[model samples]
Target: MSDIGLFEAIYSTRSMRRLKPDPIPREVLDQIITAGVHAPSGSNFQNWGFVIVEAADDKRFIRDQYLKYYREMERLGSIPRMADIPPDRRRLFEAAIHLAEHMDEVPVIMLACTGTDFPTYADANNPRSITATLHASIYPAVQNILLAARALGVGATLTTLHYFFEEELKQRLHIPTDKEIAGLIPMGYPHGRFGPTTRGPASDVTHWGRWGEVGQEV
Candidate 1:
């Protein structure tokens, strides 16, 4: 394991988009993928796949599509201006813009996908919506990937903007029609430092037995 302790990793594993062009070690990549597969799944059905992309040609294709949609979103006023976000998040927004511009240069990209149609256990209006549970089978694995990457001192960030062209992405990558891409994770050495994330104190967000109870800090 890395010198970084588990709690430290959790606190310092910021979503890092400003990454160096250095390649991640093959062994390290294998470790991260192994970590992801170990994550628990509903009913022990690990219906997830991780598609790793490193070929220059593939990255170029994905990057072009990402830029096309990002630019269109920005022009349509869908992507908020950095100045409009809170001060604490301005840096993150700036980093996102930078990533969008240089995405093709990143050493590796991983696409997390589900292998089947979303499982439905209830009507759309059910208090616990089926849509919410649909991701329960895969998101734990995605979180495992992020945490594992950080443990290896690899910089990474989760993105879904590519979903704007999901069908196109599948066609370009030859991803099976039954699979749904859940997230895109770009990984490399960080050009910037890893640090604690900013957020409201735990006490402010935690509750007791009831909602809005605002109990003591966790």
Candidate 2:
């Protein structure tokens, strides 16, 4: 709503793992939460909830949960299932293992959740209209937090692997089984310099109208 230099913010955000370990102040955490809750929701259902954790023990617990899942994936031979995946793809996932091992080193973690049950996904009266608006709503808030962090010299990345083992995560976090954990954002000051990123031009995916109904617009 502020139209506060969004292009720069969007272009600057990237997944940053290394952090400076300086704690995020409570006031800024409040602002990030406020920004996320302000995200558009379907019919004002306002189902988004964010849990912010900075305590050392809690952070370690979450990181261990990640390792539990990662080990399970490795045991199940999920890595080889990516036989079709290029080496670059494999490296990224392997990096996830490294991040999990180091997750506790970050200064803060924000968990974005929706107050909806898994069964609701199959419910005929499911608030598809409501939930659909949620990601769009919360993500901008996430972006706002990330950009604000960058501008403040903090580093962060929003990731979602925890949701893959939602049951274990719920048991560990004591969150009810109903809520949908959308993502986990880890934040802190950068331990190293932020690097330049590469991306394709917008024209590759942008369409003037009637998506993919190409060759008809200027």
Candidate 3:
């Protein structure tokens, strides 16, 4: 929207955990949410709901909830040690730790949720398996939010660590029990710079007509 082309937005959108506390303008926030709403939904059910937290008290409440488990994980040695991860990704984990510590200072916390349980084809008795419909319905919108924020020069990252306390979040936010929390996005101006993402080359991961057939000629 800010003259950031579509592919430019896509390529530059990074998971920004180290974010400044500067408040996002209301107009920019609205545009990000609008971008999310415009995403495709299965059957056009449009069952998603979003809650944006900017109030100090609400941010504290959610941040405390997140830290509860985060601290527990730390005490239990569940968090990956810096020495364990490869050097290339060690910085990301470090930034995640920083975010956990300062989550209360985030200017905005966006919670993306589904307003209704997704219809499933699996038998009710053995419905422990996840269905594609559930993800297919909500994840596109989450991606749109990240891209839109990037285009607006806002930093955004999708996280589900808060999902561990989803029910508590619903009660605190007054979201009904029927709704499902898809993602929790932290938004603000980035303390770090945006850059192209690092990843395995597409050729290494792509398959042609068959599985386990990487780099097949077109």
Candidate 4:
């Protein structure tokens, strides 16, 4: 129940990876999920599932798995080295590493999952057949959760690193076989401050009537 305006929340809500270990109140967590559930879904299916993880043992297991897979990916050259990252984006890279190193310290980890029954027209031969529409159904709710966390002064970031070890995670958490995890968000009080985020102007990427056209027509 923050008095902050919606646009203000939207503009200032950066992905906060450096979070404190201090526990968030249950009511605040409830509000965040409530906001998530209020988001729209395709065909009004609203077939989303959220798993809020707070147990220390569970967090530790997830953290270990994340680090293990992260290092493997790095070894395979899937992730760029520190020297390879652009100077302007290195901070984000560093922050992500920091989170991976200390993910267990984060207070709450929310798993955003989607039921598999949503209809799709993707070709069966395509590897990414279900990905596009499946994400379309769940990511809005994830965005809502992030915005709600920001308004409530909780730090959070959407991550999909868990996807690497998703099957094990589902087994450990007892998630249904028919659902797929879309995003994993770690939430807590921030170790840093929330501020305005930098981004290119919409007009820079916006096109009207056709591609490569900038600016709007009156």
Residues 1-218, model 3: lDDT tens digits: 34788888888898999888999999999998999999998778888999998988888888888878887776677876666778988898888878877888999999999745555543565443334566677899999999989988899888888877998888988888878888989999998887698766788878887888898544
> For residue 45, what is the lDDT in candidate 3?
80
Q: What is the overall TM-score of model 2 with all chains considered together?
A: 0.76
Superposing all C-alpha atoms, what RMSD in Å does each candidate have to the true structure? Answer: 2.4, 4.4, 2.3, 2.3
Q: What TM-score quantifies how close candidate 4 is to the native fold? A: 0.92
Q: How close to the true structure is residue 17 of candidate 2, measured as C-alpha lDDT?
A: 77
- The lDDT of model 2 is 0.70
On a 0 to 100 scale, what is the lDDT of residue 114 in model 4? 95
Model 2, stretches more than 4 Å misplaced? 1-4, 74-95, 117-134, 171-174, 213-218
Model 3 residue-pair collision total: 0
For residues 159-215, could you state the per-residue lDDT of candidate 1 as single tens digits? 999888889888978899988898898899998888787777898888788889996
> What Cα-based lDDT does every candidate model obtain?
0.84, 0.70, 0.83, 0.89
Clashing residue pairs, candidate 2? Answer: 20-189
Per-residue lDDT value at 187 in model 1: 90
TM-score of every model? Answer: 0.90, 0.76, 0.90, 0.92
Which structure among the candidates has the greatest lDDT? 4
Superposed by TM-score, candidate 4 places the C-alpha of residue 165 at a distance from the truth, in angstroms, of 0.4
TM-score of model 1 vs. true structure: 0.90
